[model samples]
Target: MRQNNHMLFRINLARRKFLRQGFSLLASAGIIGCGDSATTSATTPVVIPPDTDSNDTPGTLTTTSTPQQVVIIGAGISGLIAGYELQRAGHSVTILEARERVGGRVHTLVSPFTNGQFAEAGASRIPSTHNLTLAYAQHFSLALDPFYPSTNNYFYLQDNSVSLIDAEQHINQPPWPGAVNRSNFYKIRGGMANLPLALSNALAEHINYSSPVELIQQTNDQVTVITGQDQQFIADRVLCTVPLPVLTKISFSPPLSEEKHLASNGGYDYTNSTRLYSQFSQRFWHADNLNGWGDSNWPEEIWQPTWDNGESSGIIQSYLRDVAATELDTMDVEQQIANVHSRWQHVFPELDSYLLTNHIHSWQQEVWTGSAYASPTNLQDSALSAYIGLVEGRIHFAGEHASNFHGWIQGAIASGIRAANEIHNAN
Candidate 1:
């Protein structure tokens, strides 16, 4: 009977893996098809002319004789990529970033942890189906590793914990329905920030860090971008790549259309999310022969960030969203850390003595970001998605929120390429 149960677990795992991969393939193709707002425009179709140079790569744009001056807001992936592609096409580009650092939500932290262990505070994993993201990673020559290579996972519910491998016997049933089993998730080696760092390094001279955009004024022939520091930049075109929540802070000349304004204000759903990373002096979870990935009703989910890093010390991360995030937000940093530690201990008593240090990153409290990423409230609202990416006069919009692959790095890259292509074709 025991042998039969083990065989059943293996069979179920294989079946789940197959189904997950099939669904992922379909979803990727669907997102790619629906992600291009320029082609799916409701009003006038955006016509992207074929490359005049046959040798030009798909992502690279052809150089133009008359270069147009372009100003990009927010030095995130979308803005940086837009600036890089535009400059490569022989256009003068200037990028204005509100924060001292770039990479928007793709932040990686190394300090406060020992033994070369690191953790991602935001935007941790990349799905294999994200071709554009993969292309950029390949371009940068960044190494990739499985996000959760181990098949073993833990579930803590209602004050009880069980390994997924023994879940059937413990719970007298199979694992929870709709549980993801595929190993398609990946993270960049060194850190996820390496992605934006590569793009930033390529456009070092063009990026103006700590320059926050205040307002934008566009005319028939030119557009003017004003910074909070009272500096003004004039360009032939401007791309607004700031997050929707942050975008609301910037004023536009003549104001945006009512629909667009509303969309930027709150039409999209930006989840209140928080991430906590805790490093331990010893690999307590691994010593128990259990993968340090877990989920619970209390804190949404938790995973081991240093699982594939071959580090003796371990880093476990917890993600809290919605109400859990709100509840934690009310507490002080120390209180929040204690709360997470206590809750993690409740799930795994072994973690109590091994924890050495902890760090917290609250996206809800992040000034420029406000929230993690935007999600469509109404799934059928294709126009809502398409409208955000539409070119508004000489001003353009590009971000993860504007793409169908919302919340992923791929969305940002695709949006940036689309915006750059729009400017290049116009030239």
Candidate 2:
């Protein structure tokens, strides 16, 4: 979640200094400002409704199906919230998700070690500006924990040389030129997935998971969704929340409007590709007195070692940048581990003593989602406006990409609310 080179450089440098001092920067300059004051009672935890029971096979396309009150495609945050709001508006809503589970890109991975540690494979943090995400936490009694990225770090260059940087001073300064913008990134207290989990809990009855819509055809009147599993759902109003790249591939009976098509095509360029964060049960970085920041312009060299929930423990978690994507599938487990170890040797000379289990999440490999949410490029404004714009007839599009905030849980929620408002006003 970094942008603009100068900002990134400054933030990373400052982060290194802060971590080396164990968050002492917050005390000196009020950086993060006296820890989070937000807390919620454990007894009133957010409630997620029970799972659904329906299944649809892919081959049976039904044309005779009439329009439902409302239908949403994709159950990611946008889809989830859209359904939630629509149902709240008293319309019969159906959410068709291509994946088997909910939460879209917000994945909170529970570890097998059972030591109370978890890692997020997708969409991990929410900045203080993420109003929607924070609001839900407050409404559901979820606690807010501070995720301080301003700490010590290791830098890897193309020559494979490593440089240790102090986060405190580095963040306030510039790493290269544009690094200052990187300071806003933050992680959620419970987990990145908790926000979506909270929303899903609020809208359990209306969603249908594992239902990928293969075809979206609209006549003069209503839209019909044909699933890969052959089941069908018809609705008067349809909200498409699928990724832009995927949306371009799906066939729309008479074809979408020129603006919608252009938006879908143009939006792909903004998509942010990501390498999943690997989770281990131990905090190896703490043992070696390191802040788990190992970065390189080359993807393979930028393996980062991070701590789990525990501030102390010898088990360190690490994840390589997208560089590993090219060779990930071809390499064996032993080779992959060895490659990661090689990179760590540069940033963390003492890493060998505290290393534990290793896990990797390659978002590109996920069939449900090809990559992370879209990143805003120069083309962002027009493309986002196009995708978020109402079709004027009966179609609406909502998702993380459709949001102005873009690429976080809050964007999804905000877009969902926006789409709901659009539908409500049309009636």
Candidate 3:
């Protein structure tokens, strides 16, 4: 069933008002936008009680008193955190992950570099303002280090000559349109993957890797979730933390509400992006007194992953987003690597000899997650942002996109906590 045009018009007006109000509030608070390096007050970490009983069953909970069952779709950070919280509260949780791996965007490439050095192919840096992410890291006892070292770096802007600048100068430089200056960035010691690995390990027996959710059917009381392999899980509630685009692929028995359907199908912007990590035999760029982090007119950002790792061999990563990423997707891997190499060589001619091998990770090519992250394009449609964390009866929505802090792990964790609390309070 489609929503009436009149109702949609009203909803659109309301959304525009809401966004205007939100922007006004941000302006008053001196907040420019999301994903910026605004200093956030540090928060005290909450102590989560450890699960006492061990349940080997994949979809069962072990508690003195029986609790409500929750079937979580997608084993990404949001889903995993939701499952972890629900399980801690004595609720039965069954996480369905499409890929054999757990972390959706928090991927780390381990073997490409020598001396135990690695590079994060996705979701690398953690801003200090990301309290939930830091809190989770604290809970898991994961170590964090500065993502970028305070040093001089080279910037090769739009086929321009290389210019050297200090960290402060580079950070203070004006950002591109709708972009914020990022001053503080941190990362997990091993890789961003460790965050999900810790959560997944804690829920090892309850998570079903390689199990992709195919359909969700909601009755008056019970919700039934089916996987691609025809595995069915009947639960009192289902929290869907899958990306909005991915959620569109799963059939809903009662069908999503008209507004939700529109929001899922058209409202969200699944950023077309690609990340390339190149391993080098020696730290040639570092030896040249270059931080190996720079921006180019070719529409790519380059950074060294091994800056703080204390490793001789390092990995240089190139990030291409939006149109640049779309253009890169059309080319072959060899051509893409060649192009990146050519650009870097133009800035630092020494890179030609130091480059050993390269690995590419395209979020668009990833079937489970169709994009790098979700950024809503039609903010005027209030339903788009409203339906983000909205609970449709037995089904609850969560993910980075669903949260106000979209494109960050903090958003995912915040959404998971919100979804878990909603379920916890309901039943």
Candidate 4:
């Protein structure tokens, strides 16, 4: 879902120019408008404890501020990491989450499919250049795999009406959208969800699932949180990690700054993305030496999420965005299936024969995340976005939206640490 800034970056450049240059983990000229992940501050390696055992050592806070009660809203990676760091720093923490399950946009689906096959609902790739993201994953001891199959022939349905197929080239575009080596791109061995699930386990007792915060009232000295259940929780400071759109759902006392309201109301822009996954009885594309990963003139990415799993039956995920995603969002699950199924048959030829089951996940439709990621549309939105991470009295904000790396996992991780530090050292 967090594919805004660093999605399948496409341009009208010549095909040769695309394959010759290769894609970079970083963005070029703000292709998706969330800036490049490479530009984010990765100087300090963020330390998020793997677990919060009762017998664990106390925090090593380096500031003069004494331990304080902290309330974190939204249990996404941002909130989870902030809670983890602050709790480790000897601060009392309470994480309020609206969702029953953890991992906001970093979702991995493993169900009904055979042989433990799964697909990511959001934030899949982990670039080698992303130090913080890589550090945290390694700190957790998770394995990594090449995101793309480098040795296989690729399919390039370069356009809809023409449906061009460049079987000779390994990949039609750069691996991502820059000059970065394709080998540098990686994914978690199991799924992207493992990272968040590990963090959630560490803070299991502190996280309140299904506890949606309805209101936030902050005075100079403290912040008061009122959940949907009418329960009141007070904290010395509050870290709000919800996306810009989700902020509108909660009532903020004294209201938010005019800049924040403008940013959320209509100034800032976020991308719309939806992923459709179809499981087939066999990996038919292999017969033609096609790795089952390609892009269409429709401007969507076709990925066999389980490509490296070496499974006979695999899942084909159509990563849709903007106009294409909007069209899919209009249809229900069945209609979404028919739409992609019809297109895949034309693109994959024999896909109709091996089709097993299908599913769809739209980021725009999520209750907690109205859009994929924050990407201010024009100069106006970008100008106003400066206020996104600005601390308001006892309340601090952090999320992919608040970070320069908008769509990348590095952004969420960095922003979480930044906000946590803001309150941890506050005098």
TM-score of each: 0.82, 0.72, 0.82, 0.83
> Lowest-scoring 10 consecutive residues by lDDT in candidate 4?
31-40
Q: What lDDT does the true structure give each of the candidates?
A: 0.72, 0.56, 0.71, 0.73
lDDT of 4 by residue, 208-241 (tens): 9898999999888889999999989999999999
RMSD of each: 10.6, 11.6, 11.4, 9.6
**Candidate 4, clashing residue pairs?**
1-122, 22-174, 23-174, 23-175, 23-177, 23-178, 24-177, 24-178, 159-297
* lDDT (10s digit) by residue, model 1, range 112-187: 7889898887888865556567556655656565455333345564444543543223223322354222344567
- How far in Å is the alpha carbon of 300 misplaced in model 4? 0.1
Q: What is the lDDT of candidate 2?
A: 0.56
Sorted by lDDT (best first), the order is 4, 1, 3, 2
> What lDDT tens digits, residue by residue, belong to model 2 across residues 122-182?
6755554444554444444454433434555534444467666655543445333643323
**Could you tell me how far off, in angstroms, the CA of residue 211 lies in candidate 2 after the best superposition?**
1.0
